[model samples]
Target: MHPSTPGSTDQHVLHSAAQWLSAGSPVWLATVVATYGSSPRPVGSLLAWSADFGMAGSLSGGCVEEDLIARLRAGQVDGGQPQLLLFGDNAAEQARYRLPCGGHLQILLQRLGKDDLAGIQQMLAWLSSRTPFVREVSLHASGQRLTLLQHDSPQTCRLTSEYFIQPFQPAYQLLIVGAGEVARHLAALAQPAGFAVTICDHREEFLQGFDAPGAELRCAMPDTLISQRFADSHSAIVALAHDPRLDDMAMLDAFDTRAFYIGAMGSLATSAKRRERLTGLGVSSTQLQRLHAPIGLDIGSKTPYEIALSVLAHLLAERPQRS
Candidate 1:
């Protein structure tokens, strides 16, 4: 699967459920509702099970999933009503589940009825559309209910004794404004790290031999593509083209966007000259400050791959933290 594929692990479970449903099998979905201490999976991590396909996704590294599957097969969790199961509260239970550092987890298990299937299908649609949303599961005295709320930013999954809310956001994207060796290496590294990678270069020859799996290649002008395709907050724009004509133009366009990270690859002297040129072109001080020139960390990198690693390391540090 592409690293930037939407929904992450939760999406995997949903896809598995859809497949099992299509094959005329009943599916069970499990979500981590809450975690105390050092759980293997975060809140909202998912697992799916069907008699035909066995299981998909995971709730723990191994043992918790095994126990969940065993219990399902033994008819211990057969009721259609949603149930919350706790694991690793005691030393023996912790050893039984092999939870790391005695972590405790609360799991919400639900059988896929007709309505649940419809909801899963809807969630899949939203994920495919790259729409951000929140799935709220309420376990109240009245009954258990699931609701979807539209939102721009994904909220952290949280349990408040009555409700469990898990937010879903679109995948992160990286727009590389060059097809050079550094750009190629960076694209390869970013793709596996869950970035939707796109490489843009007007130089057709440079792009012709580029080989980064799962990255979209664009032969259009870098600046135009940056402005058109990467105006989102979750996007990062990096100019790795050695030519100032290309890199400067892309950086100018990037400054006008909400892209979280805007960077240019160059030496310190080259970056200083570029900054002067950009300032003369009417770029504000604040926007210029956002540009990561001499891009990448000060790792004393010389080779193309090493430079790519440094750039990726800096990007990871600059990325917004999610709860």
Candidate 2:
């Protein structure tokens, strides 16, 4: 897994916690409630620790995990109470946790026992189904108890004096309109970065030769697959077929979806031609603006792998910024 990539670590933590919880183990979940200065992990960052498995995620990018694990082992956080702990707030603490740039992290630790097992399993189900929901944890006035609630609504993650409300967005989905080298490379890079990748192409020969681990390959027309199977708010549709018959149709269909990112790979001249063709096919000028033709950041990429890296970089930059 790419440890520093956004959302990827949270997925890992959730999966690990599910496994441990299924085994009837009491797990402690630590969430980064607030951050001051240049914190390594963002708000809502998670780390799950079980007495048997140690730790499964990261709150800070340094020695903070070690110290937190020590506290858990020493029974400092085992009192069945939700504890709000501060780290790197002072010079000595900063030095001890090795927090870069003197960043400080406020974390909420909640101990989950057998009674919480069903809730954890339900969360895992929601994640597996790519459902959008919010998990709200409110601390009691006595500060010795916390309640977890799940609901569908406007997504948000905020920490107040007595509550922490974290929204869990569905995993980002990437639909590639070709099974070529660029698509394979892109899938390899994107999966580690927390994207659920799907490659759709009608060519049997291309499908036979394509091999990108963890990426689902669909032997169907790009437009058909896109219109029938893909396209959501958290989805990204990329056309890398380099053929108007395929790329144009895919982009046309993608324009109707709520996908945050829609791009097509080509040269500047080729992209202009594609746009003109799309316009001729009844696509509006305003809708055409959403199409990121000549996709990927301008990194002067030449090789297929370099082009893949460029595309991934652009996707990362275009990811929805947390509020």
Candidate 3:
């Protein structure tokens, strides 16, 4: 993550790496190919770096990167071949690396040259189109190599003797309709969780009242934004306007998209009334079922901050399942 942004996405890392390659900098891409037990970073976590281009992602969010960099500089972990480095295997190793208790991480570290730039750009192009793809790393007698394959759906990140495979897609986005304190708080909280947030409000005056760092603000109709941008499997739509004129209209277009999560901010009673109103407006039973009124978990949220917390939690829980 940069100092200006709340968090970094894998797509951002890939783009940064590509930029470094274009500059003729020697770069290396690190991926957490396997995690066992209480790992800090999940499998498929990515980090791309160059001695001159700087670093873009995090594998452990701890001392692993620093240690690996030191090792690489000292000529300890280099042979110009893709290698799997294991960390936190035992108590001594755990203490040395500051890994979580019982946590083990297996990292696939590869050195990339100009030859890989074409494939990297192709992957970036696929991501730009919001397409999912599989990055297959194969172990061979000479060294580990990679291939990029287009995929319709995301697959589990797994490693075997012959290959380390991971599915990748575009960054997950959150389109929030109507701007208010809750919207402000949600945008702030969701960004750190790796959700790129966009807030849209038709109310020009109301739109002036909301502000959050790294959140894209739009003073336009919801249909144009939802249909054009948020109509993807990697999107989550939330109507927080609390105004039926805005929220319901947003809902009408949202249900037609492939957004994985669709919700509205309201109480139980208000949600029931909302369901009735949407049904009367010709929302199908299936579409209505997809809507999560009284959005967020039953976390007993009271303040705007707490409500945003609950909503982000719900999104994080359902993120992998749906998207």
* Residue runs of model 2 more than 4 Å from their true location after superposition: 1-8, 141-154
Q: Single out the weakest 10-residue window by summed lDDT for candidate 2.
A: 141-150
Residue 14 alpha-carbon offset, candidate 1, angstroms: 2.3
User: In each prediction, how many residue pairs overlap at the backbone (N, C-alpha, C within less than 3 A)?
Assistant: 0, 0, 0
Runs of candidate 1 exceeding 4 Å displacement = 1-8, 140-154
Candidate 1, 40-104: lDDT as tens digits: 87777788989888888888988999988889999997455678999999999998889977689
Better of 1 and 2 by TM-score: 2
Candidate 3, lDDT over the whole model = 0.82
Q: 1-323, model 3: which lDDT tens digit per residue?
A: 01111124777888898899999997888888777777777777888888887899888856898888887777786646678999888989887878888887989888888878877887778777766667777654323334444454335666789877677656789999989999999999999888889999888999775678999999998999999999987799999999998999999999999888999999999999999999999999999988988999999999999999999999988784521
Among all windows of 10 consecutive residues in model 1, the one with the lowest summed lDDT is 1-10
Task: Enumerate residue pairs that collide in model 2.
Answer: none
* Model 3 C-alpha RMSD to native: 3.9
Q: Estimate the TM-score of every prediction.
A: 0.88, 0.90, 0.89
**Ranked candidates (TM-score, high to low):** 2, 3, 1
